[model samples]
Target: MSRIGVVTFPGSLDDRDALRAIRLSGAEPVALWHDDADLHGVDAVVLPGGFSYGDYLRCGAIARFSPAMLSIVDAANAGLPVLGICNGFQILCEAHLLPGALTRNEHLHFRNRDQWLRVEQTDTAWTSAYQPGEEILIPVKNGEGCYVADPATLEMLETTGRVVFRYLRGNPNGSQHDIAGVRNAAGNVVGLMPHPEHAVEALTGPSTDGLGIFTAVLAHLGTAVPAASRDRR
Candidate 1:
């Protein structure tokens, strides 16, 4: 089985949820400690959302120097599939794995709600299961969810199709161009400000659309179940 590593930082609140979501997607979920320097031979990794290191000194500033992030940074740069959610997304930017930075929401409040997202690009390892132009519903909660980038970088991303997800309906955080997620140049590393793991089950979420992301990565790694076994909603 393709084992996916989920890093748990000191103040992480959604690591367990990510683990469960990975298991539900038919992959083995490995728990990785933030203080550990090893990756445990996992095929891919997930930087789950949370208030890492109590979100002090900026949301992900403190957590970026954790030991686990060292290996993650190295692996992600080498083309390993890496998904960063919410605060994790912030850390990715802080660590320079992705472009842009997440700042305080335009409203200056911690917004928590089911957010609608449009799949702007599906060429990434994490978004391959979704068709281009598909819409999904996922939960988003954060005080700093607004994404900002320099004009040059923003234009490059736009020209390269690196924008993976975009907010639908009304903009939730006043992110530039409604960008909800973005990917590295290689398209294996992705960072987003929404909680996809939280929306994998209909009973606890508004929809199971987020499951596509997990399954997409598995498929990209050649470990996903046969097409016949895939539950196409």
Candidate 2:
């Protein structure tokens, strides 16, 4: 089975949920510590949401220098699939793996609710299971979820289809361009302000639509490598 690694920093609150979501998607979940530099050969990695390092000095600024992130940054740059949710999104920005920064919500409040998102780009590794324009409901909770980029970078994202997900019904946290998520130029690294892992099970969450991300990564990896190589991983 494909092994997906979930990194746990000092204050990560959703690592277990991400692990469960990975298992539900028919993949193995590997627990990777924030202080570990090794990736354990996992096929993909997920930086789950939480108040990492107590959210001091900014949501993810402190956690950006975690040992695990060093490997994650290198792996993601080499085309390994990486997904960042909420605070993880903040971390990705701080690490410079993706463009823009997730600032405090426009309303200056910690917004937490079931959020509706539109799949704007299905070409990314984390969004391939979704159809273009498809809508999904997932939970979002954060104080800094507003995504902002310079004009040039925003235009690049719009033109290159790097904007993977957008807020649908209402703009929660006032993200620019209503962007809920975005992917790297290579489409292997994606960061979102919503908590998809929290919505993977209908019994526990608002919906199961979030399962698409985990499944999409598996599909992306399957097609990217030779069948034999995939089997070995």
Candidate 3:
């Protein structure tokens, strides 16, 4: 089975949820420490969300220098699949792996609620199972969820089709263009604000729309191409 590494920082609250999601998607979940400095031969990594380093200075600024992050950055650049959720998204920005920084909610308060997201682009390692324009509902919670980037970066992101997810109903946290998620230029690294792990089971009461992310990651690792018959290659 593909081994998925979930990084546990000092304040990560969603590490276990990420592990369960990986298992549900038929992958072996590996718990990696924040200071390990190694990926433990895992096929992929998931930076689960929470108040890393107590969200000091900035959401992920302090955690960016964690020893384990160095390994993750190297592997991610070499095409290892990486997914950053919420504060993980912030870390991606802080580490310069992906563009944009998450800022305080426009409402100026920590907000938590089920969010509606539109799949803006599906040609990514973590969203291949979704069709362009697919809409999903996942829970989002955070104080700084708004995504901001310079004009040039924003234009480049838009032109490259790197924007993966967007807010649908409410622009919860005021993410730019209602942007809920984005990917690196190479598509190997992705970051999103919503917590997909929290929505994987229907017993929790909401639709299981978030499961597509984990399924999509598995699809990325597998040799199977999505909609294989539609491929002309």
Candidate 4:
């Protein structure tokens, strides 16, 4: 089976949820520690959401320097798939894995809601299962969910088709251009402010839309190599 790792930082609250989602997606969920430099030979990595390091210094500023993140930086540069959700998204930005910064919401309140997102780019490794322009409902909860970037960076993201997910209906956090998620230039790394792991099961989530994210990665791995040889990588 394909092994996908979920990194648990000191304050990570959704690592288990991500693991469950991965298992439900037909992949083995490998538990990874924030302080461990080794990836445990997992095919991909997920940085689950929470106020890492007590949200001290900055939301993800401290966690970005964790030993695990350092190794992830190298693996991601070598084309390993990585996903970051909510607070995980902040860590990706702080680690320079993705562009832009997530700032406080315009309303300055902790907003939690079932958010509707449009899949603007599906060519990415973590989004291939989704169709272009497909809409999915995922839960979003955060204080610093507003995404910001300079004009050039914003233009670059928009022009290159790197903006992966966009908020529909009303803007939840006043994010620039309604951008809820973005991917790196190589399309192997993605960071979003929504908690997709929370929306994987219909019994609890708004819809089963979030399962697509996990399944997409599995499919990517399947095509990348045969199942028996997958873990060897």
Models, CA RMSD each: 1.2, 4.2, 3.9, 4.2
Model 3 stretches with alpha carbons more than 4 Å out? 223-233
Residue-level lDDT of model 2, residues 133-181, one tens digit each, is 9998999898889999999999999999999999988998888999999
- Runs in model 4 with CA error above 4 Å? 223-233
lDDT of 3 by residue, 1-233 (tens): 67889999999999999999777666789999999998899988999999999999999998889999988999999999999999999999999999989999988988889988999989888988778998888899988999998889889998889999998888988888888999998898999999988887778726677777877877789833334222211
Residue-level lDDT of model 4, residues 98-171, one tens digit each, is 99999999999999999999999999889987889999999999999999999999999999999999999989
Superpose all Cα atoms of candidate 4 onto the true structure and report the RMSD in Å to 1 decimal.
4.2
Cα-based RMSD of candidate 2: 4.2
Worst 10 residues of 3 by lDDT: 224-233
TM-score of each: 0.97, 0.94, 0.94, 0.95
Clashing pairs in 2: none
Write down the worst ten-residue block by lDDT for model 4. 224-233
Off by over 4 Å in 1: 226-229
Better TM-score candidate (1, 2): 1
Candidate 2 — which residues are off by over 4 angstroms? 223-233
